[model samples]
Target: MEYQYKEVRRELAARADTVIWLDHPFATVMTRLVRRTVRRRAGRVELWNGNQESSLWSVFTDPEHILRWGWKSYGRNRARVRALVGQVVVVRLSGQGQVERWLTGPLAAVGEERAR
Candidate 1:
């Protein structure tokens, strides 16, 4: 997770950065299904930190797949985070002046994120 975050940070700072970490290959349900099918049908192999891609059977046969987690978390967390952020003064910052104020003013001292 930290490596992914660091890659994102670096990508933002660099011009035309080819960041593999930022690329979530299984971003869509359809893509994941396709990938799983191809892997199982063709015996296409994949390894993650020395683990094989669950023979592609997990895309359906396994309930604990990442896709399941995504489905469950997306509904719950989006609303939860929205409400949680409402407790803070979420500055939907759009310009440099706001960023400047955030650094030099009380926005930084709020103990949490805040608006101008």
Candidate 2:
């Protein structure tokens, strides 16, 4: 029998001290997704449990495919994260530069502490 709350993730987030969000432009995300998808399909990359991308045709035919889903959900996710600004210690990184800056700055402190 299940003993956990329905919203366990929210419960955990409430108690968490930090949440680092890797935010990127929609174009960048789409570009990455397309490249990754093409590479995986061409190479027949074995994912979890020997699963691989079945067909390139699915990219066009599958309306709920990764490419479509990512494009559609981008704006909704951005808005949701923006709403979390006051409730959590959210680090919203917009691009590679911001990500690198955080990794070398505030994030480095956390990494150094963990190494001790």
Candidate 3:
């Protein structure tokens, strides 16, 4: 639950250990290995930085089936990401304060990876 100022995005970009992926896409499929909820739903939820998650009606507009895709991969993604991000510093934070600290602390470095 750490959040860094947008300015920090630049700092992280300079770090070698940091990886930034924009316009990236993936799907979540439920399988025997990944037993999770399959809810075909989307809503216009507010996000940080004055953003909206997405309107529920958009599900029909996007061919990617954003909501359905995400619902399928709920549990599997975390495990996949953790394995993919090996050899990097991982911090499991459970609150927003930790995010504040990282933004003001060592996490300012670009390319540095920390998990919460």
The per-model lDDT (C-alpha) reads: 0.46, 0.77, 0.43
Q: For candidate 1, write residues 16-110 as lDDT tens digits.
A: 22221212223454466556656645764544565554545575777766556555554443343244343433334334455566567774577
lDDT tens readout by residue for model 3, 6-54? 4553455345364321112232232421232122123444446766545
The TM-scores of all predictions, comma-separated, are 0.35, 0.81, 0.34
Which ten contiguous residues of candidate 3 have the minimum total lDDT?
32-41
Candidate 1, lDDT over the whole model: 0.46
Candidate 2 deviant stretches above 4 angstroms: 1-9
Q: Which is the leading candidate under lDDT?
A: 2
How well does candidate 1 match the true structure in TM-score terms? 0.35
Candidate 3: what lDDT? 0.43
Query: Which candidate has the top score in TM-score?
Result: 2
